[model samples]
Target: MKADAFPYRAPWWLPGGNAQTLWAALASRRHFGPAPRWQRSRWNTPDGDFVDVDQALHPSAPDAPLLVLFHGLEGSSASQYAVAFADFAAAHGLAYAVPHFRGCSGELNHAPRAYHSGDFAEIDWILRRFASEHPGRPLLAVGVSLGGNALMRWAGELGDAAAQQVRAIASVCSPLDLAAGGHAIGRGFNRLVYTRMFMRSMVPKALKKLEQHPGLFDREALLGARDLYEFDNLFTAPLHGFRDTADYWSRASAKPVLHRIRVPALALNARNDPFVPANSLPTAQDAGTHVTLWQPAQGGHVGFPVSHGPFGLPGHVRAMPEAVGHWLLTHL
Candidate 1:
């Protein structure tokens, strides 16, 4: 069967109903293996602050086009998807770097401000710095999940400006409609599991931020928040200058910005992606002329496992990075 022919149709209840099973599988797939080697560095932001970055280079190809990778919420370069994608890029003689969002590089950010889905200024800073250092090399951007949303938003806002520097862009499993995604994730047992798991990581970060910046956030609100919406309402919204969670979600979702993208780009989504509903996808007609939407059937969220040959292939996963790398190599 052709790779694109794998069943992409999904049921309406899929995003909300199968949350636990799907997320559990994703967590297992992401955590089961040892991380690949990467060198850590610090990039000084324009604000006189610093952000940590992890770079995996193709030792033999230092002058190759650089691929800037962005991981999902609460994920860093250590994420399995990030590492695997880096490996694939390196194999293709591409140099890749994954920047750790504030507080995500195993070190807490110094300020109360944390990373958000629509924060493009930091990315702009990174790109400008890269351009200055590399001078002539092309730059490509690739992101997964939350990072995907950020990249799309930035591309949309940049419009024609992105064409001057970005050779190509690719995003996988990005939630184009954050409000819809939050609503979907809040239903039934999914709400309990996803909220619990995410909060386990987020609440600690919030608490640490509170300690660093006294009176910065509502401690009681952070502790009592039950879902991502509530958590963002109390924490992310105020810190980012948004009026509320709804406002933040509305501004952050990438659907409104897809048409503005003017560079060669690819958006891939699994029909059965547990975090994003299929209906929430940015309409194909709405995409820019340079954009390609690759919808594959079986990959659940980031799960693209395929069985090979007669013996039932176990413990194997076909991730999105392979397709992304192939497309980048062909187009860029």
Candidate 2:
């Protein structure tokens, strides 16, 4: 499938990359209607840290399709995209789960390790547990940004084994090439806006974690990181056992292994995404037969705003859920 199969057009009122990217966390928050009651489950890892999984299900249905959602950098249950997707899934009577990365589930996670862009082991644990708990239901997934990258990487690495776990998968606005993505978001205007937003949430949590596990590293160096690369170099790389940011970025990127994926998957990205450049977006040939890179020219990052809808309701309709939801509905 190509981008033409599921066309998306941004509303004229909200033009440009900045408008669409920022609106979800700003203007679109007020439009969130009644939310689903998400049952929370916290998993304590062998490493002493923990991750949280929030499940939103249809009360009447004992068995339903499950879409495991993975949020972006520093995002949680309250993140604009997560909340919107949860409610949207509930409205559609789909069973969904949102797994919060370590140190991102309201309270600080224990131990020295935290989540990174390529935490495939953690993702595998979550997927395995969910599959076991649900038994026979068809398992699907939709990952946003960082989580999307890891999910794609896992699929690529697993090859045929992935098909057994997930029937189909969707990844939105993920940084397939971590080195390219880092360079794009680590400089110029993105450094000021996007970088600041990520750090604002990440830094506090890092500091708190450092306090819990003393003598871990230099706190000042972490506080001084001005870009994504620098943050990885100063804290994430060392904590995760990588030599440097380059090492971490290169090893964690999904681009190198995408061709190995055997499960049917859709990789959606906006050509004008602020953090990921158009040149870095995957081509159909690059993704092999199992994957398609559906990139629209205009939807900035994960935002696909449409002014008109079924009842003429106007707001930023999140494309991640719309595309993934529609695909899962028909494919499953």
Q: Who wins the TM-score comparison?
A: 2
Q: Which candidate is the best by lDDT?
A: 2
- Weakest lDDT window of 10 consecutive positions for candidate 1: 1-10
Q: How close is candidate 2 to the true structure, as a TM-score?
A: 0.94
- Candidate 2 C-alpha lDDT tens digits along 1-332: 35555577777777877788877566664224476567899887777677889887445255777878988888877777777777667767678889998878788877788888888878788888888888767888878899999899889888898877888888888999999999999788888898898889888888887898898878888888888888899789889989999999999998888889888888988888888899988887788888877888887877776665564345756555766688766767
What lDDT does candidate 1 reach at residue 84? 68
**Residue runs of model 2 more than 4 Å from their true location after superposition:** 1-3, 29-33, 57-60, 308-314, 318-320
- lDDT score of residue 242 within candidate 1: 93
The per-residue C-alpha lDDT of model 2 at residue 200 equals 92
